[model samples]
Target: MKLVQKWTVFMLGLLVVSFGIVLTIRAELGVAPWDVFHIGLSNQFSFTVGRAGQVTGFVIILLSFVVGKIKPTLGTIANILLIGFMIDLLMLVVSSPTNLIIRYFYLILGTVIFGFGAGLYISAHCGTGPRDSLMMALDKNLSYDISIIRGGIEVGALSIGYILGGPVGIGTILIALGIGPIVGLSLNKVNQLKNKLQPKIDCYN
Candidate 1:
């Protein structure tokens, strides 16, 4: 894998991630926990979800710097801008289905897609997005399992988002409980596939 390949994977992963996020919004059952926070900010501040996400990304990036003493990578910067824009763009064209069965389908599909996208970005190894960076930093500093740290982050975000009037439903709880394991599973599968396809060089390159 070359630098260009890494970048392409990173960008594609973000696009896929954003599309999945939009799908969840369209599902209308609820959203992922961090997204619940973003929606809350959007509602309270009179901004779009993308705008709120970008602002939150900036804040999280700064926190990552403070905690990890690392500068944002090009991948990180791209993740912040690209996912935000993609979500807004997708929202313009997509809408929620009225049927209950269809809505639940979208929710499950979106969560799975989001998990796979996250795995792809992590496999790219260019860098992590701001929120993920913060989570990783905390995991390192606190010597906790990634799963535990992720759950804690979700709980914190959910609590704050709820307080700030973010929408919550069964889907939120589903995402909160399932995302970590899904992401880990996806990561393993992706790495295995990458290794089988290109055994000579590091997939991250």
Candidate 2:
């Protein structure tokens, strides 16, 4: 029963995060750096963005497993598959707002929701998603501060995606700088709530 609840929460988080991703893309201000790379691949290779994302995910997973020695968990597998599906499905259904102000609203809303979703799954403590696992693995193996490694990854992705003609805008910069703090805040809040809800142990005489 506990396992079921955890899985449910994880899947729900994935769905919410994927929706937020689609919303960000629809806003057209910019996209997450990794997503920019996916979009660039789609534009260059004539594949759908979702397909490109799946391919990229597989490669990253492979690298993380083979080179980084990170093992996969069910949550990791689900993340790779479900997030792509949700993003594609959401894209089909959700259209971009025409008004610039409305679009910025979407961007902000998407970023917040994305952070919340991350907090949900992470608080579950089942497992790390592929990208996240990879990030941690890289940090561990390379002996660099996680922040520095993350920054390097984002910069590399952004540069390659830009070179490949992915859309770049203010939102891209905003997400790069802001998402860490946002997600960290969400995680702290969620963890605190979880601790509060947990049954306290009583010591017997």
Candidate with top lDDT is: 1
| lDDT tens readout by residue for model 1, 22-85 | 8888998989888999999998997899988999999988987888775788888888989999
lDDT of each: 0.86, 0.82
- Candidate 1 Cα outliers beyond 4 Å, as residue runs: 136-149, 199-203
> Which runs of model 2 end up more than 4 angstroms from their true locations?
140-143, 200-205
Superposition error at 135 for model 1 (Å) = 3.0
Indicate the TM-score of model 2. 0.90
- Supply the global lDDT for candidate 1: 0.86
**Residue 195 lDDT (model 2):** 70
Give the best candidate by TM-score: 2
Alpha carbon lDDT of residue 163, candidate 2? Answer: 91
TM-scores of all predicted structures: 0.89, 0.90
lDDT (0-100) at residue 117 of candidate 1? 89
- Candidate 1, 26: how far from true, in Å? 1.1
